[model samples]
Target: MSAITLYTGAMLQGAVITLELTAGATVVSLIAGAAGAVGRLYGPRTLKAFIFGYVETIRGLPAILQLFILYFGLTQFGIDVPAYWAAFIWLCLYGTGYAIEIFRAGLQGIPEGQHEATAALGLTRFEAMRRVIIPQAWVAMLPALTNFVVLELKNTTLVYFIGVQDIMFHARLGVSNSGQPLAIYGIAALIYIVLNGTISRVGGILEKRAAIAS
Candidate 1:
């Protein structure tokens, strides 16, 4: 095959790999984040502290360092995970912290009267949250969480360090093998920009729909 032809396939595969990791991380993070956010919002003092600690700790640390620790340092203790798996785990952890913060912010953005009205209607806290609070919180939080997903998609390139052969990694290989650094890297950049742009557009549409809903 021609150099460009082979490189294109590799690039596509790399993009898929990156998307898979980001998708998995997004799902995991959203669940954990929603749970953590709710925990912080309504849990007792000790539970709130623990949730706060987790979000603070992850947010304070560099994600690259976190990935390295999980991939390299943890492996040294014989708790080894495959490079892709390690990358996936670290990404989930990193994204989860950010999601928690976003959800918390969304939850807080909710009006007090909304919750009060639910309780005034005889709804318990859980029912109020399930049927009233979370849906509205989701709308308020959509912009932030959507932004976070786009960020996670771009940041998936960091997995290259763990030898996951993601988009950046394949782009690097293409540049090295073809001696066309500009072409290879530019292609990767365009792909990422397009992907992120699409996400942002979708987010905008979602926001509009949410505005209509609320």
Candidate 2:
């Protein structure tokens, strides 16, 4: 096979790993963000404080620093996190911080009358949120959430710093072996663009559907 063909194949293999990391991290972060937003808005004071601190701390620290702390610093205390898990965990936490704010804003955007209406109907807070508040907020939140997913997908490249064999890692390897940084790195960039483009497209479709439903 030609050198270009070999490099492309390796990069494709790496893309699969990138997809796995992105999907897992995005799903986890969305769940965490939604929970955190709800807790901050209506939970006990202590829970609110805890979620506030977590969001602040995660947002304050750089993503690379968080990954280093998990992958390397943890070993100092004998925790010994695997590289992949470390990367996955860090992305989830990082994405969740921003996601909380996005979701919180969406939730808070609902008028106070809506809350009163739910209470008047004898709906519990949880029931009201699940059945009424969240659906409205979700439509407003969809665009921001989609942007977060795209950002998370790009951030997956940082996993290579911790030795995850993701797309950028394979691209780097191919460049080192074939001494064609331009072509190899270009291909890697293209792959990321395609992946993110697809995400944005899907997000647009969802947003339109949500708007119509709302």
Candidate 3:
């Protein structure tokens, strides 16, 4: 049988797992990031300080190190995190660190007059942020959010280090079994390129639409 035929099933399965990890991480990270941004921007001093420290600390650590701590080191603390959960959590936290900054910058980029106008209309803070502030900020946030998604998608490969059976893991298996490192690794690279390219294309379209809308 041909190498392509031999490896197609395993690669596809791996791709699905990678996509799942990316999707889950992206969603949770965005939610956490938005909340973190809001807290830093509008909450009291203590909340802001706490969020700032969390973001700085998470951003400072390398993701691989964090993953190792989650998967391996946690066992010493009598908390055994499953490899898949560890990977998922790592991706979410890592993405969130950057996402918080992206969202904060986007929200802050809006003019102070916008907030004033909302107050003048007697809109409560929650209503103003939900109805007026966030909608406007989405345009500014889209490009950065898109970049974050792509980065997270690529970073999913790191999950295989803890044996999550992602694309790279399957590629390694294919290499070992078929002894065709070039073909296996080449296919893995192509898969990533396609996924990243798709995200970029979609992001570009959204950006254009947002620009026209604004």
Each candidate's root-mean-square deviation in Å?
Answer: 1.5, 1.5, 1.4
> Can you write out model 2's per-residue Cα lDDT over 1-214, one digit (the tens) per residue?
3787798898899999999988998899889888899899889999999999999998888888888998999899999988998998888889889889998999999999999999999999889989999999889889898899898988899999878999998888888889998988888989988999999999999999998988
lDDT (C-alpha, whole model) for all candidates: 0.88, 0.90, 0.91
- What tens digits encode model 3's per-residue C-alpha lDDT throughout 1-214? 4876668568879999999999999999999999999999889999999999989988898878888988899899899988999999999988888899999999999999999999999999989988999889999889998999999998899988899999999998888889888878888888889989999999999999999988
Worst 10 residues of 1 by lDDT: 1-10
**What TM-score quantifies how close candidate 2 is to the native fold?**
0.94
Off by over 4 Å in 3: none
lDDT per residue as tens, model 1, 62-106: 878898899998977889889989989898899989998999998
Q: Look at candidate 3 and tell me the lDDT of residue 106.
A: 96
lDDT for position 42 in model 1: 84
- Candidate 1 wrong stretches, greater than 4 Å: none
Count: clashes, candidate 1: 0
